[model samples]
Target: MMWRKVKKFFSALGPGLVTGASDDDPSGIATYSQAGAKYGLATLWTVIITFPLMAAIQEMCARIGLVTSVGLTTTLKKHYPRPVLYLMILFSVPAIILNIGADIASMGAVANLLFPSVAPIWFSLVFTALLLIVIIFLPYAKFVNVLKYLCLVLLLYIIVPFLTRPDWSEVLHHLFLPRITADREQIGMLVAILGTTISPYLFFWQTNMVAEDVKVIRKQVMVNKRMIIVAGNEADPRAREKRVMGLLLQKMGLDVNLGMLLSNVIMFFIILTAGTALFPKGVRNIETVEQAAQALRPVAGDLSYLLFAAGVIGTGALAIPVLGGCLSYIVSEALGWKGDLDKKFDRAKGFYGVIIVALLLGLLINYLGISPVQALLYTALLYGVTSPVIIAIILHLANNKKIMGEHTNSRWSNFLGGITLILMTLSAVLLVYFQFFNRS
Candidate 1:
């Protein structure tokens, strides 16, 4: 019975796990590491606060997909004004491609740390090409499962934090109690962490994946009902009702809320790991994931270093595909092209073409001699600025009765989402203030 339950649980896990794991991409790792190294637990409070906000936003995205059977872009294109949809995608696609470039660079940096002789540029190009091939050719189900397993590498962060033997009382105090030092560098790092944690790609990916899952569910349900009808007597209404209810329960058992909670818990541990391992050592400067991994060496030993490196590489692999695929989804939706991973490449020519172009462009960006660290920072700032518009559209779509039907966001969801929108608004304000005003 226990084994059966475990199998069932594994079978049900998909969109939530993938979205959560993608949150810890190499750039995100750098942001979290910088937060810990710069202010220790001072910025740790944001992690706890952002958990529910992440869930609320993602849940709305999921709800939009499940109810509308359309991706966010597609829905926006149909329901919202064209100008609004175009404006959102205009900011979103380039930002996503830039992020892919950063992840590629970060992955190469990790590989270079391990090998020391491999050139970062060569490794980045090779990695990007390999990722594009895998995502473009591989079956969608297989690609998703591969990403789920890659998430296991994140456990290294969990283990590394414990090995550091951080002061528990101090960790708790800093986490629950906020601190502000009035330092610009510290404030900048805080904003970066917030931007990284609550990203826009996750929003697009989560909604589209949810739509994909619903498509699968709907197909399975139709097939199952046909099978049951054939197996039962034609006049047996009771048997038909029983079969339908069983299917409903099976679908509901996925417990999406619970999955979101588990994902947020993993995120909390990541922030905790960085807070404990790098924060107290006065290592204030970090521009790369490799640096964060190396910082774990003396404090958490060789195993920790290996673990951090593995996490970076694995998460990078998981995220690069989603980043590429998201751009594909947005463009396809904008241009009125059919887009679904379940559909064959030949059937969705424009969709697959967009994915290929985005991936290739991302790969080319690495060879352009741009510093990946600066690219990552710029990506964060870009997403920070663009997130408010996306959030506004999402809230408006999710609340529209014509789109979500009965699955429109609940009162509580709207309340939380409104609050999240406000928080993002403030973060964007601070980001602009620092970027332009404070720079002088």
Candidate 2:
């Protein structure tokens, strides 16, 4: 009975779980590892703080997808001005492609670490090809199922910290008591962590995933997707539909909360591992996933080293799809092109074409001589600059009765969403100032 319940619970978890796991990609691993090496456990508080904010924002996106039966990009195109939509695409697409590049580079570099004979670029080529084939051939449901299982690979991080036996008391202290400094490095790192955790690409991806999932569910409910909710009928049919939607929203909330919690927990442990293993040894500057893994060999042993290196490859595979998919969804939706991962390549050429182009471009970043670290930094700057606007738009969309109708944001949702908006805006400002204007 217990096993059955557990299985049922996991079965219900879909896009939210995948989204959360993908957030902790190779680039994010480098950010957390850098935080640990540079600031010790001082940054651990960020994981705790970001959980609610992340969940709230993602939930709003999910809700928008569910109510409208369309992706956020399409909704924006319909209701908002053209320039606003273009600005979103302009800031988001390049950054996402750069992120995909950094992840591909990191995956290749880490693969080379495990096997010295194979050159990193060769590994990058092989992995990029493998991802494209898998993404293109697999049906949407099957591909998502594969991604759900891939999320378990993050368990590697949860185990690495335990191998080193960190001090429980110190970990607890940093986890609760927020510790930050005013210096540029610390501020910039803080912003990077926040920017990475709550990204703009994720907003587009989550909304699209929910939209696709709803289409799938509606098909399952009956022959016609329109049966799930009747907009004009305010009597029994609409009321019954609202109840069904309420249950779905409840489940979605659980999935998003659990997924965000898992993401943050893995994040906490990655920082902890670096803090315990690298910080005390004066190995502070970790710019790449390879450096983080290599740094752990002596202090955290071969097992820890192996796990860290392997986790990078797993996360890269998991995350690059999301990165590519987000960009594809944005472009596909904006252009009124048919896009669904489950759809055959012949059916959705523009959709899959965008994904293929993004992957190929990402795979070329290493050959272009741009370091994974540099790609991530540029990605962070762009994400920081653009996320506030996206978040603001989501808040507006979620609360707008015209779009959402009766399924608008509750006061609690609005309160949390408001906080997320303000915090993200402030972080973006700080990130820009530190990266460019603030020399000191």
Candidate 3:
């Protein structure tokens, strides 16, 4: 009975787990590693603060998908004015592509660190090709399973910190006590961490994947998809359907909370590994995943370095598809093109084409004399600046009774969502001011 329950629990986890694991992609790892390397445990509190907010917002996104049976972009295009939808696409596409580029480059750099013979560019090309083939050719179910298993790769991060045996007292102190400041560098790092954690692309991906899952369920179990009737006098036929939907949403909440919790826990461990392993040794700045791994060799031993490097590749593989798929979903939905991972490429040409083009552009970014880690940081900054707008939109969508029916945001959801909005908005404003005005 216990084994069956454990198996069922794992089986129920889906998009949320993938999304959460992808949240700590190589780019995110670089951000967290940079945080720890630069400020030691000072930045640890951000993880603590972001957990509930991330879980709350992601649950909203998942609920939107389940209720509407559509992606966020589709809902936006259908309900909002054209400019609002277009403006979001305009800001989102560039940042997401850059994110894909950064992850691809980081994977290649780390691969080179593991094996010094081949150059990073060659590794980047090979990985790009591999990802392209995997995304385009694999069936959606297989692809999702692949991602779910890849999430296990992140366990390496949790293990690495312990290998160095960090000071538990200091770690707990920093985890609980918030250490923030007005310093430009520290604030910038904080914003990067926030941006990496509460990303906008994630909102679209989560909603769309849930919508897709509903589509799958509708096919596999047809009776569960019906909603309410409009005639005032008519008796409702959706009582059983409503129960099924309720069960689905409950499962989704469990999936999302667990996923986000895992994401942040891995995030915390990465920071701890970097802080304990590199910070005290005066390794202050980490610009790449490779640099972070390399710095671990002398201080944290070879096993730590090897695990860090391996985790980079695993997370890059896990995350790039999500980045590519999200961009495709946004474009396809906005343009009214057919798109789904389960569909053959010929059937979803425009959707798959957008993904292809994005990956190619991302691959091209590596040759432009830009540092992959630096680009990752800047991508996080861009995400930080633009996410508040997206978060506000998500909040509006979640609360709109017309959209959600009786499933609108609960009081606690509203409270957490509101706080997320305010906090992200302030962080964006501060980042902009610091970047443009306080450059002295």
In terms of lDDT, which candidate is strongest? 2
**Cα lDDT tens digits for candidate 3, 1-440:** 98787556666787999999999998889889999999999999888899999999999999999999999999998888999898888888988889999899989989999889999999999999999999999999888878888898999999999999999999999999987787888987887788789999999999999999989887766564343321123355566577678778888999999999999999999999999999999999787888999999999999999999999999999999999999999999998998789899999999999999999999999988767765665676677777888898899999999999999999999999999999899888877787779888
lDDT of predicted model 1: 0.77
**How would you order the candidates by lDDT, starting with the best?**
2, 3, 1
Model 1: lowest-lDDT 10 consecutive positions: 246-255
Count of clashing residue pairs in every prediction:
0, 1, 0
Q: TM-score for model 3?
A: 0.94
- Give the TM-scores of the predictions, in the order they appear: 0.90, 0.96, 0.94
Candidate 3 C-alpha error for residue 107, in Å: 0.5
The residue ranges of model 1 lying beyond 4 angstroms of the native Cα positions read 1-7, 226-263
Residue-level lDDT of model 1, residues 311-417, one tens digit each, is 88888998888888888888888888886677777888788888788877777777787677878867877798889888888998888887755557779879989
Global lDDT of each model?
A: 0.77, 0.90, 0.90
Q: Give the range of the ten consecutive residues with the poorest summed lDDT in model 2.
A: 225-234
Candidates arranged by TM-score, highest first: 2, 3, 1
